[model samples]
Target: MPFDMIGGRTFYAYNSHFKNIMLKCFRKLSTSSSLMDKRYIPRRAVLYVPGSDERKLKKIPSLSADCIVMDCEDGVALSKKEDARSTIHQILQSQAIDFSGKDCSVRFNSVDSGLCEDDMKEILSASHLPATVHLPKVESPQQLEWFAGKMKDILKNSNLSEKLRLIIFTESASSLLDLPAICRRGVELSKDSPFKLDGIVFGSDDYCADIGATRTNEAKELSFARQYVVTVAKAFKLQAIDIVYINYKDLDGLKVQSEEGAGMGFTGKQVIHPGQVPVVQAAFSPRPEKVEWAADLVKAFEEHQRAGKGAFTFRGHMIDMPLLLQARNILQMASHS
Candidate 1:
């Protein structure tokens, strides 16, 4: 038998036919030369905190989230937008919030909101700039192009054009439909441009409202949209972050949803509450058994390659370049996590 029993469940130890299929699929995906760099930057749990809340801002240094997003968008009240921007600028400038080696980003309002320009201006003017800028409600490639153009001027003036990265949030059906094009623009911007497109985030709350669809605990309503985001992100080699789990009180539900998101190919999840951070991070991290298997596969593949073999058999399965790549990715993720 090619399967092995582990923890009372059957695991596919080897399957030559399945390996061949995966090899073909990966080869097709790799053909896209425009694919962005797939660096494993531990973005498993991205926590959002309202920028206007000084109490919350003060507490950020103690949190263990892989990425902290100081939100100036939907998280802030309309009347408090200016205050939030000012507060965020102060927090960044003070350098009082210790990132603890975590990535920091600021989510500005949408381009159409008429407040994004001011938000960018204030945030960019800070002495301690965020590593990334998150753009919400991205609907078209043109909007990204416009923002990129504007950011060029800001970053040029600040001398940080090459340092600041960008991650866009898709919150509407229109954005979902134009995902591929948006991702293409992202790739284009990263090349000889000031701002690099690091990833794409899905905002299910806004998307559900935009589509007039009711959200349920089962989450069947978001399957197609979520899968589309993951597919486009993988095609472009960008990170795909899943929607936030609003039910922060339900830890079990959060874990279940996080596992589902990870299974669906999302590299990370967004969280509103601090308690959800560890759960999401654990869910997206590589399993110990999988990491061990990946290491073994790499070792065997290397030995075979040293013998001048392009493809070889491993535990009753075919080991090829695609499979090698998969093993390497798994190892990389495990090491970073």
Candidate 2:
């Protein structure tokens, strides 16, 4: 709030303690290891294809993204909203695209926007359905509840074999603040619901606009919000999606940003361009060195536990429960990647 839109230095200066704040946030993040033991689908690179773009839509089946989001929200223009919905509906119904081994999603307008009903109506007309629906700009738990009820009413009689998963965007101050409550509430309602809350995607551009955070080349302005979203999302056993790299032409910069997000524990990234998918996919994957370490650690952990060994030092670091869980996660990722 203290800086101009293009001036990020003044903003960072005021929030200089964000590093410490992020550290504190992460220190309190880990929950029971049983949460980590649950099966999670890989969402390493979430590629958003505008529903109105026929060229991109035709090529969607060829893209190797872990998740494909047929977007009818921000990516579509107001004038083409109906057209986008029609196009997406046709694609799903026609089976023009083979989405085997990949997760498909549709991004509807925010629940508050009055356009979500139209989006739902389009989906209802189709016999086919996406595995996920992305809800952008959802700031409160009530909105999530509303969507759940609305979706149940609309899709109750549909012949969907899989329960649809919902992913919300965390790009506003209110969203960042009430995120935990939203997830907790969603988790509660999900136990018996037709649709479930699955993950949170960070929309940095809208978030910065909402909070008046100045722009930065490397997005340092979004550092705290980014890390905080990942921490809270993981705490509630939900996948955390990192912000999109707007400069699609710069694959190198995108790689750095993607890797940074991965190191921060984001399970996936939002990609707008085809070129960015492979970079993000590789960035989110386990490296060979790390995989070897994880493999060795898993063996050590198994042996030590079988031999009645408690927390012991491995490679000069304490192999506690959290690290052991992390090691297991790495191995799982290694096998999947």
Indicate which candidate wins on lDDT: 1
Best-fitting candidate, measured by TM-score? 1
TM-score (C-alpha) between model 1 and the true structure: 0.80
Residues 1-337, candidate 1: write the lDDT tens digits: 2333343222444356534533443334334343224334568888989999988988988887889999999889999999999999988898878887688889999999999999988988888899888999999999998898877777675665335778899999999999999989878987866778889999999999999999976688999999999999989878899988887888778889999999999989999988787677778877757766776776675566569877778889987655666665665555444
The per-residue C-alpha lDDT of model 1 at residue 327 equals 63
- Tens digits of lDDT, candidate 2, 1-337: 1222222111112243533432332222223255342435578899988999999888877888889999999999999999989998988888788887678889998988889889988965777888888989888889888888888888777766667787888778988899899889888878767677789999999889998988675999998999899999989878899998989888779879988999999988999888787778878877656655765676666567679988888889987766765665665554444
Model 1 alpha-carbon miss at residue 22, Å: 26
Between which residue pairs do clashes occur in model 2? none
Error of 2 at 123 (Å): 1.1
| TM-scores of all candidate predictions against the true structure | 0.80, 0.78
**Model 2: number of clashes?**
0
